[model samples]
Target: MSLRLHTLVHACAVVLAAGCLGATLWNGIAERGIALAFGVLVAVGELTRHNGPRVRQTAPLAAAGALAYALLGEAGGRPTHHDAAQIVTVVLAGSLLGSVPHVGRGPGPARDHLARRTLTVGFVAVCFQPLYARGTFDDWGGSAHALLLLALLSLSTLCDAVLAAALAHSRTGWPFPPVLRDELRALPGIGAAVVATGAVMALGVAVVGLWALPLLSVPLLLAQLSYRRYAAVRATYRQTITSLARATEIAGCTPAGHARRVAELSQSVGRDLGLTEPELTVLEYAALMHDIGQLSLVDPVPVGATAALPVPEQRRIALLGGAVVRQTGVDPRVAGIVERQADPHREQPLAARIVRVVNAYDEKSRTGGPGGPLTALEELRLGAGEYAPQVVESLARVLSRETRERDGLTRPGAG
Candidate 1:
């Protein structure tokens, strides 16, 4: 089926299910209306969610989940203590239904992804119950209550980030600090939208009661659209860089697909070494452009010739490339990485270190100068000072995993 038609049909189904569920569960228009709004927001979030560069998918439902919990907390007939079962039921159902579009992609991964989201929302609900029972915001005016709600929502977000970072580290062998750093960095971009959505939901509940909840959909949907646009722009930027990178390869300055392969390998090593997504991004871009300086030479470095260059010549190429990249208004950090690729032993940024090792490995592997992947890895290991021991080891792990996957061999702990 066409994607648009499928999306439309799926949305209609979700809306219908939400309306029926809300109507069956709550007699009041306010309660049912809020439930419907929550359902739609969840569906929109699911449909629009984007996969990030580092294999992490943003959880777009946090704001919607907060709104739903707030609505339940403020409903007129609710008791002092909220019902855990009801919160779980509403959240799990909405999340599961919303995730239907993703199920076919990979059943296990999709289910795991949905479960994590459900648990996060459920945890937020549990956390809010005490505040709800106390009617913490009831006495406060709209502005005052909204501030309190924002504070509570921020706390919940922090908890979620921490939990997610921990899970990523455990599951993917990613390091804790970098994962946490990335999560924290992400907050300012999306957090404002989430805070606004929660505030609107709270205000709506305060003013018009449950009826105001459906109106919350407007802002929530806008936020989702904004995220979608941002993701598209990011994808475009990556593609543009990729295209530029290919230019060097086409010019015979590097081997075919050399930049892309280096980028992939560098990114893998960066991830295993616990670099933040931003760091990994810079690393990948630097790797892709590492040979760009060769374009300046009357006789460009031959494909796979970089590994054979003298140290001074290599440094000269890197410096020229760094200068060229700097002219393009790219991140100075990225330029620094390209410049430092020639001096792998120097104390440089973690990302630069990653590029150095992976770039060298790709060059060696391409030429098959000494041996193949195994020989390349040994050369990197021998230059432990030039390449960080951890980075070399990370590269080794990356290669091992790739080999196993290619050979269709299951590692001991792999599922």
Candidate 2:
């Protein structure tokens, strides 16, 4: 079957399943209608969701908000099973239909999507199961009830981080520690959103009872739109920096695409080393602009050359480049990485070490200072005291993976 037709069929199946589940859980037509309305909102949010940072996924935030509302209502002595079932149905159906646009993209992405949503709803179920048995939120005082809800939300977030990290590690073969670290770094932001939504639901229930639940969607949808706009702005900013980096090559100060190549390599190595998404982002920007100081020198270093420079000259380049970056009000972390690119490993951040190693490899490979990539890697390995061993190994692995992928693509009839 064609991909579009297949996607339609899948979406229809999901819709039917959701309808059946909702009907079974809630006998009232009005209750079923409300559940389906939330489902549609979640599906729309998923469809409109933008790609988030590497360590964080934002598409599920709206569904999470919806779930929080449902849970809060359940905590108020409403039917627990009905609430749980409604949430699962909405999340599952919304996720399936939201993914219709991406059908045929690949099995890997599809699996990741399924893994994320399944773990998400599963965690919700686990959190609510105890409340279902207890059957009353009024047994606890208001303060205790609020604290309990917060605890449940926090536990859910932790489970999400662990599961997401595991999935990422499996896919990329990255070490679990670093992957886990990345996810932990992203939790505060996502956790805040989920908690804020729960707070709103609490307020609604306090004021107007269960009927006020659906009204919570107004603010949640607005939050989603705001997040989308913020993501778009960040993307545009990245592209602008990239374009400026390329201008240096156009001016004959660097090899064509050198900045982009180093940035890409640095990101891969940084990820493997367990840098957070924000840190990786700064590393990439620093890598791209690492040679910006060369523009100020009358005798610029030759294209595809940095290792050949004297120590003092190299430090001068780093200081100057850092100053230029700082003037733009970019993150202080990015400025710090650029400034310490020439520093010893023990004195520098992991990001700095990554940029330094990848930058050296690019220069050596392009200028033929060494025999090739392998020789350059060996040279870096010999200087272990000055570089982190793990970072060097990560660079090697990245290069090897790239080579393998290139070979696979170029083989006859590969496509």
| RMSD, every candidate, angstroms | 7.5, 6.2
What lDDT score is found at residue 294 in candidate 1?
89
Model 1 residue 391 CA deviation in Å:
3.0
- Expressed as tens digits, the lDDT of each residue in 1-415 for candidate 1 is 2333323433543554455356546742334555565666566566555555443445455445544564356544343233443454555566666657766664422433544554555555556665666676467665776676677677766765676676666545567898888988877766556756766665566556666655666666676678678778878888887887788877877778888888988888888787777778888889888888888888877664676688899899889889988997778988888898777565777787787788888877766755677888898899876678888898998888677566544656554
| Weakest ten-residue segment in model 1 by summed lDDT | 1-10
Q: Name the lDDT of candidate 1.
A: 0.67
TM-score per candidate, in order?
0.78, 0.77
lDDT of 1 at 385: 64
Write one digit per residue (lDDT tens) for candidate 2, span 1-415: 1333324433544554466476645653335555565566567656655554442655645546455644544424444344455566666666777767755453223455554555465456546645645765557666786777677767777876787777667545677898788777776775567666665665455456556555765666676677677778888999988886786798898988899999998988987777767777888998988888777778878774866687788888889888988887777888888888778788888888888888888887775654777788888899898668888998988778777768868999885
